[model samples]
Target: MVKKSVRNKAISSVLGTVIVLAITIALGGLLYAYSQGMFSNLTQNTNINVQAKIIVNPSTNDSYLQLTLVNNGNLGINITKVTIDSNGISIPINVYLPPGQQYSNTFPLTSKMIAGETYTVTVYGNSNNKPVVETMNVLASTV
Candidate 1:
């Protein structure tokens, strides 16, 4: 009777261990699946990037400041406003561009561009109620 009892106890101990291990594995798998589903529902927001260039068109005799803006990102942009700043004065312009597109505008200058002066251009856009801003600096031509 003593040997039979010992054998039963050993069998029960092994069976308990196997059940615990199986439960642990099942729980782990469920947790992994739940986490994957949760992550799959998450998404990344759209990003916008723009490149700008300023040049003096010789054909215009430096009377106009030409600006070239390019959208260089994967997302589309709905431009709302454009502004040029010189000596603290803000000039608003109406311009629009889409993704992977370019926009060029020439603004007439009342005075010649001074050497070493800095000019700022700001672009404001929107995407699904999100505001986007892009700024570029242009240095006055010394020539």
Candidate 2:
């Protein structure tokens, strides 16, 4: 009677191990399928036209004005960085870009323009030589 009970227990253990192994293998196959599709997700099928709307930076008496940009693209974009120049002053801006997003930038008004002088702050992109949009005739005050 004792020998019979021990053999039955051993058999039960072997069956439980087999069931666990089968379940693990099935779940492994499911996970592998999901991993393959995740990379192809979020891809845009349409053409992307990058249009940027320049938002001029705010200016004060002690500091220069700034600008913000709106991306009107259909997909995501990697903007390199921001560069600003008008008349003679050059300004550098830290920038990041996303699809249909907006970012603000500040460019100093170091150019020797008199108070009440009007200037055009042309905003250009890193990818293209052309300006996406230009904020022209901004009111400048020397104060």
Candidate 3:
């Protein structure tokens, strides 16, 4: 009787160990699959970043141009230079862009401009050493 009880107990212990190991393997496989899906989606959506439209308020004179720079990129705008081309005119604007922040830039004019003339503002970007250019259209009609 003693021998039979010992044998049965040993068999039960072996069966319990096998069952627990199987459960562990199954859970590990499930976790691996879940992690793979989560990481794949994260990498797929982080391609390009850009900035949004900014509000501008020109100075008291039509000869000067004021700008509000907004960082629409996932990073900083990294403005290299701000240039303006008003129908037969051209000038360089000053800029200072903070990371994920907005700043106002004021450009001094070298010539007189009309109130209803259209002007183009072009921003050159070099964040992360990669050069990019963006343009915005502005007019002197409204304040």
Identify the candidate with maximal lDDT.
1
Model 2, position 114, has a per-residue lDDT of 47
Deviation of model 3 at 15, angstroms:
23
Pairs that collide, model 1: none
Span of ten consecutive residues with least summed lDDT in model 1: 39-48
lDDT of 2 by residue, 94-133 (tens): 4545666777654454544545656555544443332343
Give the Cα-based TM-score of candidate 1 against the true structure.
Answer: 0.50
Candidates 1 and 2 compared: the better one by TM-score is 1
Comparing candidate 2 with candidate 3, which one achieves the higher TM-score? 3
Query: CA lDDT of each candidate?
Result: 0.62, 0.50, 0.57
lDDT digits (tens) for residues 64-99 of candidate 3: 667566664455445666666554444443444545
TM-score to true structure, per model: 0.50, 0.41, 0.50
Off by over 4 Å in 2: 1-63, 76-86, 127-135, 141-143
Which residue pairs overlap in candidate 3's backbone? 50-72, 50-73, 51-72, 51-73
Clashing pairs in 2: 55-67, 55-68, 56-66, 56-67, 57-66, 57-67, 58-65, 58-66, 59-65
Which lDDT tens digits does candidate 1 get at residues 1-143?
45654433355778999999999999999889877865433543444454444444445546446666666654566777655566443446555556567777666665555545677867787766778887878766532
| Poorest 10 consecutive residues by lDDT, candidate 3 | 44-53
Q: Of the pair 1 and 3, which is ahead by lDDT?
A: 1
